[model samples]
Target: MPRPRTGRRVRTLLAAALTTLAPLVFLTGPAQAAPAAAGAWTPAPAPVVSHVETDDPVVFITIDDGWATEEAAGARQLLLERRIPASLFLLPDAYERDRDYYRTLLAHGPSRIENHTTTHPDLTTLTEAGQRAEICGARDRQLAAFGDGPRLLRPAGGATYNWPYHNADTRTAAPACGAEAIVMWTHDLTTWGSWTPPTPELKAGDIVLLHMGPTLEADLTRALEAADAAGLSPAPLRDYLLG
Candidate 1:
């Protein structure tokens, strides 16, 4: 039931065309993640955009996972009333399990959903095939369920990003899934409870992360209020990167 991705197909054809003309031109190796530095990639299919480097008056709020039965409703309500923008990195199965809950979130407006993974695994530990399965499989499910939902990839267990070693799939999975970027956060705000990191506050161009958890509602409320008091305007990740 997933909608076809015209862009993915186009990339496929373009690769073929370039392959046939190989004798006439030169090409660089595909962009990779291993030399995993701390920022965005220079080339297209750039897997990750950790933080934007502009003085724009925008901060980003991105919530991770879905079907968190305890706090999803409260989080959804807070997002709706505040009219603050947030980008949610969702697990496809989790969202599908509670379609009615997430459906209301979409209806509430001012939010966009992006990809987390199908089963939520550490991509650095998986083979390339496994990485693609996790990334593309989840995206396909999201498309099937929500009709073109989720266009960014956030590898599971991203908190350990500072760890010295990572496989190439960490970056390649983004393009493999036909995702725009491998989105990473500047701050993992633990105020609302945490699975990964504990960040202090929002700043201009900071990408904030929170999880769906017991304290999600209270944590998000405090964070949102603090962000407003500090005069930071929230925007979707896509808008900040593209626009």
Candidate 2:
């Protein structure tokens, strides 16, 4: 009877020992989580800033329309002198009138060309198919003209109607047409026709809008000066868009 009792006690101790050792085995080699799927690229959602912002002291200069040749010349010269990168939103038809002129600007390393639409129609008034044609068609035309596709789209009048019968406005359709973003004016200096420069004090990440004709040089110069005062440098629009 004493031997039987001792044997039972021995069995109990062995069971306890196995239980403790089993936990140690698990602790020594932890399981690894599975690796992310191969070739999977998850992109973040587009940012909602009116103009992209960075901690760096940089601004974006965006010119709209291909209307004023005189202003375009002045703007190009000023931008080159300042060593600043600028973006142009051109009307495809307007550009077709003088492709070489726009191409000359595009040849500059700091400048990028994008779309303003085919004929500059108010996109909010058109139908869905019409909207697509204007938005996507403008991109196609721009790509054909510049050899580089447009990554940004600016709608005419910056308006979007809510009715389903009418096409979504340029503001709404720009993203739909595969534009990395839409551009709107933060400052309008009336440089093309009036030649008046806007007041200084423009801050970093500001998107200053100007036109092509005669007063472009003065307007751009004023804007640039104001930006400098605000401690901001000009950044190319391409930096913010997908290549």
Candidate 3:
């Protein structure tokens, strides 16, 4: 069930505050043992997926995770009815929570599941082995559930470290782990509330990111409307990438 919006807002604010405060508290404490200068670990460039570019009136809609209950089903139905294509970035564990639910989503036309890690973690902070495990494990689980492998990956939280975070080089982990492309959002509606859809602009090639929770249907509907207004039609991410 979706948490009350009021409560969720308060919790989000508190969590942000605590995240900001924790580092200060740690830094002010008595001098902890200074660690040796660590060897620089460089992040490899993220793989470039061709689907991100185009002059056509289309946008890529990507939904993350499998936690949405009826909200997801409604969104799937809406998308199918509209003949819109979308991609799902699934956290394998979450999908496991309700295998039948995810299968229902797959049964809906114009959708594909992609990897979002077995356990969502900061890949840059994780050891190479840890990263591989998280990435590959999710891929394996999705394959078992859906009878196919994911070709794209999106990192948790969109946060990166290990030097040059957004540099193309920093994104190599996913592809090396088997994903053919890495997806990042071009616009964020996080401030409007999770259930509220952002005003979508029907650019030739816009990649819109959304969560699986409340307002997903509303958001996608708004996005589709916006695309229509801009004289664009949504197309498959695969069309651009594999073509």
Among all candidates shown, the one with the greatest lDDT: 1
How big is the positional error of residue 95 in model 2, measured in Å on the Cα after superposition? Answer: 1.5
Please give the range of 10 consecutive residues that has the lowest summed lDDT in model 3. 25-34
Steric clash pairs (candidate 2): 68-213, 71-213, 71-214
Q: After aligning candidate 1 to the native by TM-score, how far in Å is the CA of 1 from where it should be?
A: 29
**C-alpha TM-score for every candidate:** 0.73, 0.70, 0.71
Candidate 2 Cα misplacement greater than 4 A, ranges: 1-49, 158-172, 192-200, 241-243
Model 3 deviation from native, Cα RMSD in Å: 13.5
lDDT of 1 by residue, 90-195 (tens): 8887787788776677777778778888877767777756877888888888888878756667778744543312234444556667666666667666553234
RMSD of 1: 10.7
Range of the 10 consecutive residues with the lowest summed lDDT in candidate 1? 21-30
Preferred candidate (lDDT higher): 1 or 2:
1
- Distance from true location, Cα of 98 in model 1, Å: 1.0
Q: For model 2, what is the error of residue 242's alpha carbon versus the real structure, in angstroms, after optimal superposition?
A: 4.1
Best by TM-score: 1
Clashes of 3: 11
C-alpha positional error of residue 111 in candidate 1 after TM-score superposition, expressed in Å: 1.1
